[model samples]
Target chain A: MLNKHPALLKKTLSAFAVLIFWIAVWYAAAAIVGYELILPSPLNVIISFGGLIRGGEIFAAVGASLLRVMIGYIAGVAAGVITALLTDRSAVLRQILAPMLTVIKSTPVASFIMLAWMFVGNEKLPILVSFMMVLPIIWQNTEAGLSAMDKELSEVAEIYELKFAKKLRIFIIPSLLSFVIPALITSMGLAWKAGIAAEVISHCKNSIGNGIYESKTYLETPELFAWTAIVIVLSLIIEWLLKLLGRRLMKFERI
Target chain B: MNEYNIKAQNITKRFGSEIVIDNFTCDFMPDTLYSINGASGRGKTTLLRILAGLDRNFSGILDIRGKCSVMFQEHRLFPSLSAVDNILELSFEKKDPALTDMTMSTLSSLGFSPEDMKKYPDELSGGMKQRISFARALLFKSDILILDEPFKELDENLRSVISDIILGESKHRTVIVSTHEIPEIFKNSAINIQL
Candidate 1:
């Protein structure tokens, strides 16, 4: 379904050509230098990826990572959305909770992970870290959505004597969805990246990060590159799925 | 004090020491059409907003009866919804059929086809949007209908059509419209309050 416009095709082809040229340069440099340890060619990376796929460890690592990240990300998003709703309803509660979440947002993920390690298992560290990273993002965006809701729409609701549930279901949810979808997509990516980072640092069992750690310790450069590729692909797949779900949820026909 | 269905007594409104409505008083009787002709920025829309209970910061002693509806100068139809859905949002179950038929009839009267109800606001022209807004306001069951220059954007023929519809439909209800054009229509047993 890609467009067949000549200019667009030229641009796309030129970009791919540049990518191939770079890979060729890397291969040439490895051959001229005559050192496999210093610079492994793209072929070596591909061979390593194929070997890993044949061994079936890549899918296992990817599945483990995806499950952990999805669990933590969904929990973070739910908590953040609920907290935002609560704060939006009560100014006093917002004032009380605002500074604390602000501090959480400003704090470093590494610091949160290390602190979390003191009280939780290594398995829980990734989830906690991911939650911490995603909470502020979802909360801030949801609060912004609530604040940006049109006053006139509320006036229309009042003029018609729309009940609380009707107003929330018909008006507020749509307003919130418009804002939350983009924010949630953004936060989910952050959650996955931070969750894997936490797992790598904590050396969690049966995780992609553990495989990354194992590869690094054994000086398996190709394996490290493969895992990185897996992470990128997984992240892209997740974001694409979220976007599809978001578009389905925001069917303007229903609105 | 007057024997009126709705009364606004010495109502005053200010925005940060800038007085908008200074002790403004008015009376409106049931089943009568009144036009409040006013200059721009002279609290005409603000007064309508206050009467619609959207603005509660004003100092006013007003008495109103029954449910109220308002038609803003800018057609405030939801851009995502169809004209029929916009009207149906404010209608009651008991009057659903009557409201729908009336809404469709009004739109048809205003030169809109039957398929117009299936179109979203963005697809419609400005005057078409205004007609939908007018239809929504007129079809809603309300005692006091506040229209802020509902016929401002229509052409001569459309304006006349809307004016006649407004006059005819509001015969049993109190209608307060703010407009500068067509002042002669209000001069016949209709109160003309000039600001």
Candidate 2:
């Protein structure tokens, strides 16, 4: 029942209205500043966006960065879910992983990026950084989901003599997905931000971070703004797609 | 003579410090629709759990029981799955040879139409969800049926629907139903056990 989509045209119109309001504020700020270099106006950024799109390099950069983030995201989700499952089964295993999870959660992303750059080098730096950023979130959410399982349900399975595989398929996975789906979608945005940051620091070729670096180095403020806008839009789009995927996976519940 | 017997010998259970079931003993005979009737918190559910081998920490023994399937006090339907899917899941796990027909027949006997099967627990009324939970318990392969407050939150008509199903199904099986009230329909057929 909750799966019903909101009114599409209404949502779109409201989104545009907000965008326009923000653009007006940005234009005013840019005018007061009296320099494109300090804060590019909305029009300058739009023009820069047009110029960047025409070059065709933006596509390659987006593609390269997206691929890296995706790889890292998948790795994180798999590792997190599996680890959570194992730890949930045994208190000993949970005790062992507790400190490690804490460290992963508390440490800064920049530090991880620098460490990853040293170890995995330029090409794999974003992938590692994104992986680090995503791992604890997915793990914690999966743990939450698994731990929230109804003990009564497990007793039901026991009396019914449900096999391990059947219990996992019927009750465990669905319960886990309910918790993990939101975390998965949230981690996508986190992954993109961390991945792009790593790319910028590592100066990877043919990546969004490299594009940002080039734009800023040559004093192309509008181009930098354009790249930032692209990052924001892509993150939103990817998050929406993941939500659709979540709905499909939970189609039985109608979301 | 009883066709089969489950002898409960001095069964006792305690929750923390309070003794809910204190050294109770009884024999559960087969081919009978039995109701454990008591007021709330009289350990009726607790005794059923013990009899169903769900509460093994009890002091006494409930011997000579075939496989037991239980309907819990709560609905316990998977909120994520539709009514049909919830029933079919356990049936599939049991590897029932005639899965579709078995599911359809059992649900139909419980007064569920084909269309109602596709709706999830949230979509169904409380009574309908209770009926679905009842169907899930009934579908499992077991000779001994244990129902804990099975008629809860249901209308008299729905209760009659369930009563009729139990009356028909319990003729050849040992059915233990726990409830606060034994419905008018079951008075003639059901053996009342006060807990």
Candidate 3:
């Protein structure tokens, strides 16, 4: 047990050391540059972060952006799953919708943000953009997962004449969830990036994107860096939480 | 005493012109075990797949009645679940507790104790997992048990134990097993079908 303990500790510390080294490199580079306007040091960014926290603007902006992104994320996941199910059931529907989905996936985020801003209120523009950005991701992955499902399992279902709920529980959901959660984790990152970009373009009030816009106008490089850091940190936290939840959900599935 | 319970008539399966099962016909009866021995790539798995109602592309007329359960040779246990959960997947909510309890008893007879039931597929050895797969099929309580070389990885002693348990448990049902090794099965009254 003692020998095993050291090996596990070594592995854990190695990962931690990598993170520390990167932070150190970042700090040194910022200090060497010596231009707060161009590259604010980590300390300056932290100070800016502290200032924003004290002012309560950071909290409001994060909350607003989070809410919008979550709404859009949920909508996109729902639309993607329902559309994939429909297309799976009918080849005609797949043919009709395939081109449009492809175009949506390939189009640039900025272009969608601008176009979406025209059709909806500025507040809703970020949500719509996020939804548009995340839909194809969930659709394509989920369809692939469904396509790759073991035919033998479906045979079992048919042989037993399993009901709809039982079929979903026993076969379909397990296969789909394996793909969907990973897709969702990836799409959440995309959603936040795209959603915030839309907010920045739309100049929505009380949003992190608007804070970024303000930092740019004022040439507050540290503020910009600080907000960017916040975004990265928040996204990481959410991703970690989501992954934990995904694991728990998998355990509960009895798969 | 011999009534043709299930019949496969003119069953021809073709995969893009290469025939897997070529115009095969067979009949099965209750309370008797049927064993099929054939060369490799001789449509053994294909026949089982068709009989399990998984393959519909084959040209055939199958007159089958009553419930059917199958145990593929691959031991297709769900990788993430424990042994007990895999068996439970085949069971219905409305099934008799007595039947489910009998399945547990069968698992015990095949050397899978209650403690082993808690372990996942990756945690168990190949032979142990195979028995879990066998346990699942037996627990399904079907009219016909479609087993495809279920005792592949077991040692002689374990194989004999499983064979005895299977023979004893399936007295009332028709059991069809496919295997290339005929001597290992040791079923005295099985109608041997060579494909």
Candidate 4:
């Protein structure tokens, strides 16, 4: 895997050097602060992560948060794809959705969380917020893909008088992959952050957001840092998986 | 004796205020060969696309009577699909035995090997890419086969072979060939139209 890309080795070395430099800076900052309450060091966070893991409570929180994110993500992808396809076929629908999606995208996550908290149950608030986060990104990217589709494909379809399902499977999906894969990879992280933010506001019984909130409320600075670090790690892992899937989807474009 | 015919009447095309084809009229008889030869920007490709039912932006009464297969000027093969996939995909039937066999034979007839069939368009040379597009056009086995500059990048030997094949295919089907190298396709054409 080290030699998978042309500059993979060089990139890996540079990335590691940057990581070490940041860790040293963090260590120095913690030494200067001399108080865990204000700025917990990287080592303290790691140790706190291990202690949380040993109690098995972190697993429940992670599982609950993961379930919420997955559900919201899948639903958002479905709705976004359908909406994009609808808009692509009709100028009216495109006009209607343009301002609506702009409003959704422009509004702050905190505002959306507040609205969902007022309307939705605490358990579903995270899902709603994550869904909101992923919708416009996927829709816009997919719409762009459909707009720039190869004209030859439609000509071929009309020449053959191909059925709708056949055209979708052969031409549409494959063409959309060039756009959809990257959007999916990007939105995974966005959805995770949005969902966690909603959970912090909603006060779900067993979730990472709840743990972070409790830590803050009780003045457990190390635990707060530990939860934040877990969120970052999970986000990275999910993004990595999405990128791997993107590579697999784009295998056809490679020789 | 023509069972099927394609007729165009007083066709006019314009891009903005600049007219491309002005007041053109023609008739393409069935079971015959036609060659459309013109200089660059004379709208030969545009005319072919109109006749094949691919372009409708032009103001024309073009009657394409039967199923038509077209090889565009720029070898518009799908960049994401392999050679065989590009030919066989976008069809109603995904796995028809007869269609698959015909596609394989057409690719082979066009000098494409099995290994070449698995390669993507970017992996192919310009000549190979055009050959694949030609093979895909033939795989349709339509009543009207429209080739636009089909032999521009091909070598002499392959050109003769493909020319002979087109000539043989034209005997029983309506073939419309448009090219800059008129002599390659002109030898067997029954009606030659110069725009």
Q: Rate the local accuracy (lDDT) of all candidates.
A: 0.81, 0.86, 0.83, 0.84
Residues B1-195 of candidate 1 have per-residue lDDT tens digits of 135767888889999989999998977777888888777888888888877677878897887766787787778776556777777765543336777787777778988898888788878888888887777777778888888888777888888787787788567888888876545566784677877
**Per-residue alpha-carbon lDDT of model 3 for A13-93, expressed as tens digits?**
898999999889989998899889998888888899999999998888999999999999999999998888888888999
User: iRMS for all predictions?
Assistant: 2.9, 2.3, 3.3, 3.1
- Pairwise TM-score winner, candidates 2 and 4: 4
lDDT of 1 at A132: 81
Native-to-model Cα distance after best TM-score fit, residue A31 in candidate 1, in Å:
4.8
lDDT of 3 at A34: 83
Chain B superposition TM-score per model? 0.90, 0.89, 0.88, 0.90
Chain A TM per candidate, in order of listing: 0.87, 0.92, 0.92, 0.93
Write candidate 4's Cα lDDT for A102-198 as tens digits. Answer: 9999999999899879888899999998888889999999999999998876776776666789778767888899899988988889999989988
* Per-prediction share of native contacts kept: 0.32, 0.54, 0.21, 0.43
What fraction of the reference structure's interface contacts does model 4 contain? 0.43
Angstrom error at residue A249, model 3:
6.2
Error of 3 at B54 (Å): 2.4
Alpha-carbon shift of residue A105 in model 4 (angstroms): 1.3
Worst 10 residues of 4 chain A by lDDT: A246-255
Q: Pick the candidate with the highest TM-score.
A: 4
In model 4, which regions exceed 4 Å deviation? A1-17, B1-3, B90-92, B96-98, B184-189
Report the TM-score measured on chain A for model 1.
0.87
Clashing pairs in 4: none
Candidate 1 vs candidate 4: which has greater TM-score? 4
